[model samples]
Target: MTVAIVGDIGGTHARFAVWRDNGLEQIEVLATADYSSPESALAAYCERAGLSLGAGSAVCLACAGPVSDGDFQFTNNHWRINRAAFCRALHIERLLLINDFAATALGVTLLEPNERLAVRAGHAQADRPVVVIGPGTGLGAANLLPKGAGEWQALPGEGGHVDLPIGSESEAELWLLLHRQFGAVQAEDVLSGAGLLALYAVVCQRNGQPAQHANAAQICAAALQGESLATNALEQFCVWLGRVAGNHALSLGARGGVYIVGGMVPKFADFFVRSGFAAAFADKGAMGDYLADVPVWLVTAPYPGLLGAGVALQQAG
Candidate 1:
């Protein structure tokens, strides 16, 4: 019974669990701000869970940034980690650190039939390249290509940092407002949790009113309750999400599917389903027919990164 410790580390929270019997057990979530470093946080989680790492056990962490030369720096947080130090500290024989979205892309394939909700039913062919994009504390994107040998490859990219796409006149105005504040408005500028608050603020300013919410959560909550200002912001968020998702699809030729996964979208599933997401996704002018036939899926599986870490370890073996 060889079990591994799995982690999905993000800017706002860190998720930890033990992978056993192809599923996660003893799952725990911690606020990233509560710890000084990822090591301390891992130590705390292990201590609280009364778990120990054996000599041959593997440690896999799906991080929120690029992993280069066995080192990773958090994209939205301040924690930096070297794989050697982390492995030494944990006394583990194997370690795998990968981009969080890469993990999500791999995990998307492992999802159960009911774990996903199909947003657009397109003609998806088996084993074609697929894209996964999600927005949470930050935006994440990845592509999954099947290797045709019962294995798959996850390609990680920081597509979220691309320039924001303004679709409408109102959106252009909103972009101008955001640009004035942030200098260069990347997709992450309006596609992340902090971006939600920025959108709400800009929308409020556009309507000649003061921002009524102080944080992203507050604004989302207000929007969920059908508050006018927050609802406007939420709609704007979904519209932009559709535009960006379509762009990613076209760029990658991801006819297999486009999966949306994150901590944010599932919170407002109803609004997302009813919003202008589908229309905007298929509104690529001349390429509308091509995109209209591309399926869009919303991943609902919990602990997708943990599942992906297990997949990585299995593949390595």
Candidate 2:
């Protein structure tokens, strides 16, 4: 049995779970703002669960930012950690940090059929590249390539920072307005949780209506309740998400398929399916036919990042 500390740290929330041979155990979620550092968060979780880390217990964390040179700079949080410092703080012998999207990509390979929601039933070609992108507190993306018959390597990249695409004249107008405020617009600007709020605000402003919701959750609720403006904003988000996924698929030649995972999409799977998501994904002019055969799946796994962190630890050994 391989017992290890596995975590998924995001902008607003951090989750820790015990990784065993069967699956994730003792899963817990903590507010990121409640703790000053990852070490403190882990300590709190351990105290609650009556668990302790041994001298050389394996630890792997999936963080929502770039990790390099044994250092992690959280994209949305203020925590700054070095591998050595973290080890000393947590009293762990070995620790590994991986990009959140990379972890999601790796976890996709281990998901069961019941854990996946079929958005598009296209052909998934083996040995081809796979792309994973999702919107949570922020947008995340990664690619997976086959290493061998049962092995794969995940390539993490800052794909969310890429320029947002505009397909219609109305969208171009909105982009100009947003560009004036932010200077440069990226996909994450209007594709994440905060992005949903921004989208609703902008759309409301454009329609000469006052903003309605205070946050993304409220906006999603209103949209589901048949609020016209909120629904419009949500639809736009889905369309844009689909377009971005298609772009990633084309760029990576992700014939193995594209998987959507994060805190957002799973909340309203039916809404996403009925929205303009599929149409936008296959709407690429020249590559439309090419992408039509590439499947897109919505990951419904309960704790994918934890699973990925466990996989990381196993692979390290």
Candidate 3:
């Protein structure tokens, strides 16, 4: 039987799986820090799965950051991929690479109803574009366009690097603080995992208090425990995320709805649901009504990137 390998490589973790019989098997997630390179990680996964790759086998990797010229470097990780070297080392017949968010957009199509949590109630227009945005080690964005029948196209870009939007006078003050620290503030600077911690510090600074939490997880835990500083930072995070997502929705006219998929938001799903996200999303003055009906959902499915990698492989074949 001809089999393939599919992977989703992010900044911290690299997930691998075997593609056979139209499904993924032997799925494994490895820490990127544990391996020197992606090839090493794959070899480790292959050993654990007791599989071997050869001339007829193929590989598809959904990687974070831009993919180009058969080679790419990850945005938030140190590992890099040279397509020629990777193919030669594994003896694979073919290799396909795609932006991680593009794979995410494709994966959104495969989500079951139960795998997503609705944030806003609205009707999704048939055949209209769908927006996908998420924050992990970095922020990622993509658009899914229907091509009739059941096919879709995923367009990925670095929407995360866009300038941070200030929606209030207080937000302008916080932006100035962030700008002073980072030179220029981008959405990713305040919407990602690290961004969460950074925002927490800024909140503490604004209140003239010492920041007690050291990491995003710590801050989230504190927020859940009713810590005022942490709560404020997390709430602001959700509001900013909603604003950025709304911008993307407007830019693409994504009336088909928006899917929020990422490691960060899922961590604080409960708080995010009740936070200022929905209000901020629909707060656009002239376009408030236009965005009011644009639905949004938070994806909770496991291994979506891997699933999308498999989908991309099938599409290529």
Candidate 4:
């Protein structure tokens, strides 16, 4: 089957795949960190699949951070991509590079209704803009706007860097703690995986406890294993995430819904539903009612960005 090459590149990995006609098929993943450059990693993927670029197949790459002039400059990863390099290297007819969050926004429409775990049962229709966001290495945000019937345009945003408005006095204290360590705090200071650990450290310090330095994975593991401190931090992180997501929803007027897409949150789906997240989301004073009626969904599909890349390729083609 004739297919196009596509990828959703993250800091650590690039999900590589090809879509046959209009359906997704032959999906693979390569570690972006495994190769020093995106070109080398992409070459490995093509080689393993025995795929040649002479078909002049259009290449679509969805990457974390910003995309400009068909080039992707990832903030967290060292890879700097130029479309010309890939087009020449792969002998492709065309190349398209897009923001990963934008890819997620596009992918949401492709998700099955059941694929979404709804946090609030409200009026969610397809016409209104749908917001997509998640926390991994860092936070990513995007929104899908209706262009025409059954057609949408994904817009990437640097929502993660927005200032975190304090929700309560305790949260204000948390902000102060974060500010001491990192000047000019962004929402990512508390909403990301690393941000969760930072929250834990702040909590530990306040309680006169030894701050347990841990990574995102380690903290999440401890939380799942009934570690009270870790669990508390994770719970706090979830609430903050929900609050920020609600803020995003308000800004986007995303009455259609908010879709959470990331590797981190899906694993903590149960914990999220049972945590203070829902309450925090609706805690906005006057905006509380507005957000209370807007539903939130978590994207559970794997390799969503690759799927999004495929969708982008189809549209660009």
TM-score of each: 0.96, 0.97, 0.98, 0.95
Q: Point out the higher-scoring one by lDDT: 1 or 4.
A: 1
**Residue-wise C-alpha lDDT for candidate 3, range 1-317, written one tens digit per residue:** 44789899999999998888767888999999999999899988888888775523889899999988857999889999998899888888788999999999999888889999999889998789999999998999999999989889999899999999999999998998898889989999999999998899999999999999889999999999999999999999999999999999988999999999988888889999999999998888999899888999999998788888888988887
Please list the residue runs of candidate 4 whose C-alpha ends up more than 4 Å from where it truly belongs after superposition.
Answer: 53-56
Sorted by TM-score, highest first, which candidate order results?
Answer: 3, 2, 1, 4
Clashes of each: 0, 0, 0, 0
Clashing pairs in 3: none
Clashes of 3: 0
Q: Encode model 1's per-residue lDDT on 1-317: one tens digit a residue.
A: 36888899999999988887777888999999999899889888888888764433888889999888756889889898987788778777777888899988888888898999888789886778898999999999999987897577999999899888888899999999999999999989889999999999999999999998998889989999999999999999999999999999988888888999999998888889889998888778899888878999888888788789878777777
lDDT of 3 at 223: 97
The 10 consecutive residues of candidate 2 with the worst lDDT sum are 49-58
Clash pairs (backbone) in predicted model 1: none
Which residue pairs overlap in candidate 4's backbone? Answer: none
| Model 2 lDDT tens row, 147-262 | 98888898999999889899888788778777876778999999999998888888888889999799999988899999999999999999999989999999889999999999
Per-model CA lDDT versus the true structure:
0.88, 0.88, 0.90, 0.82
By TM-score, who's the top model here? 3
Assess the local accuracy of residue 203 in candidate 2 as a C-alpha lDDT between 0 and 100: 89
